[model samples]
Target: MLNREFIFSNPEVLKWIDNKFIFVAGDDWYRRRAQDDASVWFKSIARKARRGKNGSTQQGCYAVTPKGELLRFINTSDPKKFTVTMLEALKLWDGVVQDKKVTIPEMKNFDYKVNVPPIDPSKDVLIKVQSRALTEKDGKLERWNSNGKAGGKPAVGHLWIKQAEWQSIVQNFKTMEVGETTPLTKRLIHRIAKFHLIDNTRGEGPAWESKDLKHAKVTLTRVKNGFAIRGMFLLTNQKKSLSHSTELSGEITINQSTARPVSWTMIAYGKHRGEGKYTRNARPGAQPLGFTFEFLPASKIRPIDLVPPQHMRWQRGYWEAEKH
Candidate 1:
């Protein structure tokens, strides 16, 4: 997360730092636990920035309290301003990013007249997404079944993409064999999110297991406006042959409607394996590992369609197709 920690000359951030605040610059914050001494949290959502890609060196400061309270969120502007605000309680400056040029995505209405699979957003149309890594690894998690055999392999890969779609998504996907630079299209991410939403409508799973919840410190709590089934748990997993195992502790939330999760969040924290395409720094891996399910009515969505990757590519190559 944070590659360097400086003894702040300014007393504002310093106080939090002294009180155990941590500063990080990446989405890694969402994956790992906040530092032990961190009373304040600062993270940068800088995922990646490249041409024809959805990634960008996030130019924002997402400052929050230790107890998970929003303090400041400044995107694509002078980040140092955040430090100034931290110094003053009443003083807060935000929403100072460069104005994004307005552009509209080509929208296409689906052929409803034909036998387009009738879908009901509500009810059983739930998006049951297990922890991408923890959910279905075919015992490749190196956790319970460290043998790394081909047992519980998922039908799809992370980002919930099917094999056919993945091939198309990676069509324009360029990368350097030797260098660290890699690129991903912006449309791809959005499509993946859309796919996740659609594919999940065809499944079932829990935000977490009762067995895991049994060990968690479950409680009834209020979030925003509604009641929630909140729980905290410290979990450990190891293979019998391994010398040491991994330990994780995190909080989970199951919003109103116990029988049907209205909106729930589950995050788990553990050691960092420093394994992945890009290991930015050395920090304990805090994974948002858990099952999350969400459902939405078609009426609530935008006026567009989930067309094939080829269609999008053709649109991009078409004369009127402007750069996003």
Candidate 2:
């Protein structure tokens, strides 16, 4: 049985909590003396201890999950910082706030970063096999090395594809090389980019899926009118620590699918404008309201996905793929 009370209370003395490396010699004694809640905690600790080949003289313990997620364990001295770090870690693990494109300060200038959704190589192979047909000059049969080299101008239609499949399609596409035996056709590129977006949204909440569940991913931009229904993308991570940065140009579009007629608006982080109906609203959650991109005044009735380009770059420095 696990120690329910000891684990839930966040006991101060982790060692005495019965999950430390020090209890090897007297495992039974420590287990018996420990609170019932401590059992589960102990088993977790014991498992890690075994992995470390028994306890060490090191002062602090390793912060790990029941499944052995190794969070950097620091000495329990700075409770405040630890709490903050832990919350950040949890957010990262579950991809919390992954969709929100935040502005990160840089030494010289700030760069906007996006999270690249997971792609499967096998899907790439399939996309390569299923090439969209296209016409070449004079209606002759077109041949291309890759899908990216094939497609020509689109015919005013859209292809809604899953995230993994779309990535695979992109991966298989190759531009025609100069003087290559087989000249690449224009239709391939058209097929590859044919209004198809990779839907990265899968789980509950914004992080798991794209802002619009229908979209595989979205490109952020300043709103003149509203969002595009074809699709939109948001950042997401399997790990809670997946946070990316974006540059907030003069004003940007915020697509709220729930809002009927979808009231498109903007809120600046830290700016003040002369009082009027243009007053900004509070951040969707608890963030401070900055500036407002009110659509009511413009009467533009701009559709969603019709905004300034949001240069989103994924953070390559912080990628962690689970080992299969």
Best by lDDT: 1
Tens-digit lDDT track of model 2 for 191-274: 222111211111011122222221122222222333221221223344422222111222212233321222323221211111
Window of ten residues with lowest summed lDDT in model 1: 199-208
Tens digits of per-residue lDDT, candidate 1, 30-132, equal: 2222232121122222221211123323344455443344554544323256555554422321331332223333424332222122223333222223323
Error of 1 at 243 (Å): 13
Reference-based lDDT, each prediction = 0.29, 0.27
Candidate 1 stretches greater than 4 Å from native:
1-120, 128-214, 237-324
